[model samples]
Target: MNKNLIIGQFTDAYLPITDGVVLTVKNYAHWIEKKYGKCIVICPSFPKFIDEDNFDIIRFFSIPMPLRPPYRMGIHYLDLKAIKRVEKIPFHIVHAHSPFSAGLFALETARKRKVPIVATFHTKYYDDFKSATKSDFLARIGVDIIVKFYEKVDQVWTVNSSTAKTLKEYGFKKEIEIIPNGTDIIPPENLEEYKEKINKIYNLSQDDNVFLYVGQLILHKNIKMLIESLYYLKMKGFSFKFLIVGTGKDEKYLKDLVRKLKLDKEVIFVGRIIDRELLKGFYARADLFLFPSLYDASPLVLQEAFALSCPSLLIKGSNASEGIIDGYNGFLSENNAISYANMIEKLIKNKPLLREVGKNAQKTLYRPWEKVIDEVVERYKELIFTYKKNF
Candidate 1:
């Protein structure tokens, strides 16, 4: 895979900015072009996205990050059409996902072509700058600019080990690979026909349930205590259904706090789905997957709700409650809104313990996407054979 390798990816977000670091940089340029190679992303300037055909983006000058909406901020000057498109593509590695402004433009363009770069510290960016600049001295200067960008990355990833102990308590003295993030969401051997077609498209009657909550309704994704815990599970009467897919900037302050706690007919804001076979039939017709984020570090929608079997409840020490063990397989909460309305009113009065923890979280928690892109192409061939045997 190194022979034709051209890999390069930098990112202050991309593609109309849809998060999870633009779906992990388009699944690392779609499995690094099915292992043959050639990537090149470099991001930020999205004046209405255009380029679309197996990675090769590159835009530059950006701006609007005031109280962040779709997070713009990518202005590290020096353009010259991004230095003649990285001087006609020679990069062998320069991954980075964001240590701010495309990790200082891939460390000033891989220090003028000496190449060899790597980074993937996904989130908890100092608790996202103390919830977007509420300032603890600006989240300690964004954790001293991510410990000087993980001391100019040569290696540093984190998908678990509770985010490598929050990147060594945010000083990151390098060496931190964990790498576990992948989801194509495949768990459908006729799961009750996607729970009777999501209970006849959300009208619900087959003993109504659904409690979903895909991601980003903002407020650091605690999502205003998950819409005030559905107004305390609709004042405990609990006639289920809370489905809030996605779309951010806190949609009109969480739809005016569900009409000021009236919970407007047991909350239902089914916004963004992005059709992955109808978002895997709303994660196989969810029965509970709330996710009360206290600042995530490793959450790709909790492995797309454990690849469609949906069992998430997570909150006990966020980072998606690493390998959850609350009630086992999943269900942890304790972050708030009366502890996520007492864990969704005790799994809505235990529907057979939420279908035996969603069938042990999809047959005992899974992981694929070609074994997480084969540990990112064997850490990109051991960082391109130790950067060409020390240059």
Candidate 2:
């Protein structure tokens, strides 16, 4: 077997996006370099700094995204230009993240270069379209675009099994691989100190149970539902603090709702904590992690919380639900605020259940990056071999 493998990864969003897709690709690229011989990452250029000498970066034109969440659609002209640049590189396999411009560009580049293309389904754009426009026609059109893009790739990889089933429903004939995103476990020493500092900073009392919500504060994330659940818990005389750790356009709106509900003392919005260690510390200290997202393929936050032994209350109708076994690892609830509140109340009433779920959740582990990369590399070799044989 050839030890030297050249892999090309393309995504529309990169660092500064502060979302799961960008972080997943960045982490995967770093792991590939550490485990494999060589790899290159292609993304739209940003003003922010990304220091990785081993990996090559191909910058392209990206439009300013407004109310689109983390995705800023890449221009076709710029993507074609990026495609040209990637075609010149010697890569054994091409891995595309987004099914829009970057994925389209990767498909073209792979076909021209005669390299096998592997696409990882990251975002649930169809779900986002529904939340943003609330138009079935627009969502259908979005689904059509994504279906066409993935039809050309050799192998499809979804972050979770539910996403894989979704891809199959969209007429994807290729074998779909379920490779859930993995997070580096936070060291115990770092987590312990981080917990004390964060609690003090947020003015969280030692007796008050703190529930953490860490992700983009948007309509799709269902932050309003989370706030309502907190209100419900308060009504029940549950002494708990809700920590909001993220920034988005909906920040002010969520804060307003908090005030309207008179949850001023109960809710704290700590915007965009960039430090990974500090974020993990908050996870370690939290009594429960709340994820009210209505649409998500595989949220890294849920995985991070699980890894840190923080039991979560994840909303149903998302790929993240694949990891939850109902009352075992975490609670899954309907999209409605009332339903979510019911779940929260259940957790508050049964504190022992929370600890039991968290203990069980720690056992549900994801495939290591080395194993995932090895599977990818083996797939690449098979593709190369088949292509050579046919030729």
Candidate 3:
């Protein structure tokens, strides 16, 4: 809560383009200003997106990625213009939310200012790159870039041990602190009304079992397997509403898969829901959260689901499924469509068990943002003091 400690955080994405990385930067920036000192957010500038918060922000010019239009890539260089802008902010620490373009900018500023830098390994870039390009060679290049990016940082943090192991496997030798992402949402006061709204809009009866997947509609999230699982369910004559929220580069591919599988009636692609109340409403309407991503490190979606008492159904040993006990907080399946189909079919039959597990999921939501961000800020404090002492 020291006002003297100024921090500059860098991220590649922000609002109007929601993901874990963007949400992480926003939440930390918002809470850091509320408690610690001022936190300045440096992100890519997109057209028509204005600075809409009380926090300090510096946006650099960025353009939409050709392959992935939803993503805006920063075009900042370490020239006089970049240096001039970074020099304006007197920050004690430089925190990079990603290890890409904005991260490189943060590294440059930290090097120029002789300040400590920290980075959070938010995603499995190898999988992300592979999904984007469908090329292992490019994914290897991405792994190399990630390795080199973290080499210059003073401290590294992540959300789970599986991802920490993945980082080590990718040639990063530094120690990584595992700070699980927190979920902070004020549940809609009228939950039943929200449910009714969603049911009416989606053309579903209140008796239908709603299964939800609430993140990017991409390959690495195992969305293809989810779609296949739905096909298997339909074959078995199961009746349920599968809600596909959020959009990504693979929207067309996933949609085509749904059509090919003839799941047009069961699956509903709601696109990206930016409104928090509507999002929370969809979360409340669902009976289960179906997420079976193998390449993740404690996805915030799981926490969001848990916060709303919506138990997640994920694959065993998947990073996002960590801490989720099978049949307790969530149901764990194998890395196959048949297994997911079996789990969904079984859970659909036992509605009482679904509610019971959902109740158990709430047990994992007691950790407040106040505690999570305190640990994060404490690390910033330690890294800064250590940097000053060593220098």
Candidate 4:
């Protein structure tokens, strides 16, 4: 709790993207500045997107990433203007959310300042590389670079134990600290009001079963499996409404698949919502959240849904489903469409079970950013103390 501690948060992702890592870094910057000390966010610039946070944001030069739309590749070293601006800030300890250009810049800054640096491993990088490059050899090389980056950092962190294990699998042999992601939302008091509003907007009724998925519409997130499972659910003569609330690289392919499966009427894509309250309304309206992603190490959307008392049905044994218990706080199904469909069919009919599980999810899963950042700043303090003593 050093009020004079000025922290640097470096990342490749930021505003207008709305992914988990961006949200994580944003919350970290927000809460740290509010309660502890000054925090500056350093990330790649998104064209025409003005940052309006209480804390300062320093954006560097960037170019659009072809494979990942809306996310730019930062060329931090080339941005002399940004470099000169950041040079004046007195950063005590720096944190990197990505090992790309922004992270390297953070590493350089930490070295120049003679301060400890922390790097958080947040994603399954191998999957991302293989998806973009379509080569296992290239993917392995990418993971090797990721491991080398973590090895260079003063401290390494992951969102959960499963994520730590993932880093270990990727050949990082160092110790990792677990700092779980937190949601900014809480259970809405007027849940019924939001549910009614969503029902009217989407042409749904009180009795109709509504399921939701609010993330990138990409194959890597196993969105294909979700669409196929819904096709099976329809084939089994069930009536339901599905709302997919995000856009991604595979949006066209996923939409085409839904058309091929004749699920056009049942599935609705509410693309890229920025309003948290509006998103919460969708969560409030959902009977269950369907997220079967094996790609995500730990998804913030899952916790967001749970905060609104909406339970999720995740893939059995998947990393995102690590802390979930089947048929208790949440539901789990086998990785295939048939098994997922079968589980959905059973749950859609039992209203009592759905309500009970949703309540349990709210109790077990919702951890607010305020509580999570208290722990984070304390860790920052410890790292600073130990690092300075040793130095």
Candidate 5:
């Protein structure tokens, strides 16, 4: 059987731009093209390069996003003229990533073309809205907009079970598929070299335990909480180096906090590193991964850490902690400073437990992209078959 596939995605951000959405989309697009020939990625044009043989990227004109909060909601103005360009192509499926302006345009195009529309629930926008706007009223408006936007799609997919539940709560009638993120396992040989490079950059000792934190420095990430916990440990005379990977709007604030708390020597913020292999190496070398995010939905970093057998310290109730079994593969703590500090102290006091948890974490294998793409392909086939039958 011959198949022609065109995927329409609306993301507030894309590559050269860092976030979970960009990572998910890039991974999905790469896997789909490798398996099914070619796929098109639609988003705002950024300076990043999308160099895949079978992938065609379409960037719509957009304004510069605000630097203070760091996202693509307010900055994007849907160029109906640019969107009109997609109408010229014969697309089979329209897949949107966000519920912002670009998503609305995608939905409209799908309806006009009479094609199947599929959307993936990505960001926890409502939670983010509350934090950025500080208005529950506005946050409610955002939730309503998301509900209305998603209601028009044929299929909805989420990265975690918690997000699926959230979709159902929002009055979505369609079945929401739960598909977690996946990563290519890093080889042991490469990890050793990566460790040496990282040690040289940070001046690390072989005896020192390095706790790594990878991802944005956002308020919702609750990185301050992690710094506070480290401060608490220092108060008790515990010594360890924290290697913070990635950068964001919170860099200056976090640096200030670290200095104010006298953790300048213990904490190192090694701003955003682009090399994927280097990131995987850091994951493998770390004694433990610290992610104290108070709000998230299945962050890819957690899965990356798991793939590398890096034990994690995650905050409870966050979507990333869903599949985690506390005390087995990682430790879960509340959002409070004391609770997080206590968990870190426990790990410091019991070194053997860390090794055991890392071993346990290695046992989990997540193949979400494979499974999700298979399901998506099957859905495409069904949609095409039904379209022919109906017409």
Candidate 6:
């Protein structure tokens, strides 16, 4: 164990925003600081949002991105005070969670300090660029820039092998490391107590089938298809309560679609819950975790749901569905609303099978943050040693 290990985690999202990458960065900092050594989180500032964390955080100047609600574009160079504070820390190695502003800052800091820097390729940026710009040429240019950024880093990492394939498709030919994200949720001994609490809070009855989707409410996540699937399920006389957790830019559009599809009674948009305990309770109560994201590279929510013995339904070929064995540990569906609806109906019909699958999911997918960070710390040490030897 390195008692003097000092880490710097640079990310575009933090505290106020809840997403896969944000959760990954939070867990990395939390575990690293708790068991390893000191860690400093450098992220964009959210207006009037006071960070309440045990570890240190450096909030740089930023403005909210209009296209993506609650996600701010950080301008670290503009914050001279924050830069001075960052310069004072003797960081052993720096890790970047995004290739945007915060990542650029990490690259600069690593070069200035002459330390190893690791950048994790988490999102499908090309899809994001195409969705934002509506131009293939522009999206390609953006991807090229992203590849160049990863090339400069000491090491490149992805949450899974599927995501590494995506990075290679985008022109990053370097050897990529696979370090999966972790969850802190542990199944409670008295799970029914938490489930009962969730039932009362959500006005759900024990007999009603409960489906959950916990992540950003965006179109790219195929939330529209999830709602559409509910419509088909409702038409077949299947009574289920679908809880849509978290908020995003597409929330309003999704709500409007739900109303238009006459699924307002079946689907409930439960906005973002920052309380981890309450969130875990929802996972415990859910009969199935419904996630059909085509854009997510590696979803942290899937692991969080699996941690509480909740099986997830993901798209068959999606990057997040890499480890899942359809119907054995988790369920899979084609990229269509009817397939999702049919899959949901099939799973709910067999309660014993569903429960067994949930147990299997927990056994196979749940990886604690402590163990993950132990591996991360070892990797950091190896990177630092290799860099020093070559220097």
Q: Rank the candidates by lDDT, best first.
A: 4, 6, 3, 1, 2, 5
Compared with the true structure, what per-residue lDDT tens digits does model 3 show for residues 1-391?
Answer: 2666789989989876788888888889888998888988888888987788779888887878887777889877733565577788878999998898889999989988999999989888887788778899989988998899998899898887888888998899878888878877744457789788888888888899899999987777889998999899999988888999998888999999999999998899998887777887787889888998887787777777776777779999877777878887789999999999999999888878888898788776434566788898888888888999999
Better of 3 and 6 by TM-score: 6
RMSD of 2: 2.4
Instruction: In candidate 6, list every pair of residues with a backbone clash.
Output: none
Candidate 3 residue runs with Cα over 4 Å from true position: 78-82, 132-134, 187-190, 365-367
- The candidate with the higher lDDT, 1 or 6, is 6
Candidate that beats the other on TM-score, 2 or 6, i.e. the better one: 6
Q: In candidate 2, what are the lDDT values of residues 42-152, reduced to their tens digit?
A: 877665566554566787877767776555667646556765777789887789998877787778778888878888887777787777788989988888888878877
> CA shift at 174, candidate 4, in angstroms?
0.8
Clash counts per candidate, in order, are: 0, 0, 0, 0, 0, 0
Clashing pairs in 2: none
Candidate 4 structure quality by residue, lDDT tens digits, 245-354: 99988999999998999999989989998888889989999988999999998899998988988989999888899889888899999999999999999998997898
Candidate 5 — what's its lDDT? 0.76
Candidate with the larger TM-score of 1 and 5: 5
lDDT of 3: 0.84
lDDT of each: 0.78, 0.78, 0.84, 0.92, 0.76, 0.91
Q: Which pairs, if any, clash in model 5?
A: none
For model 3, the run of ten residues with the poorest summed lDDT = 362-371
TM-score of 1: 0.36
* Per-prediction TM-score: 0.36, 0.91, 0.94, 0.99, 0.91, 0.98
Clashing pairs in 3: none
> Tens-digit lDDT track for model 5 on 177-291?
7656666444355567877777877888877878999999887798888899889988988889999998888788999999999998999888887887778778877888999
Query: Model 6, range 1-391, lDDT digits (tens) per residue?
Result: 3877899999999987878888888889988888889999999999998998879999999997898877889999999998888888889999999999999999999999999999999999999999999999999999999999999999999999999999999999999999998887877788898899999997889888999999988889999888999999999999888888889888899999988989888889999898888998999999999999988887888888888999889999999899999888999999999999999999899988989999998898888888999999999999999999998
RMSD of each: 17.6, 2.4, 1.9, 0.9, 2.6, 1.1
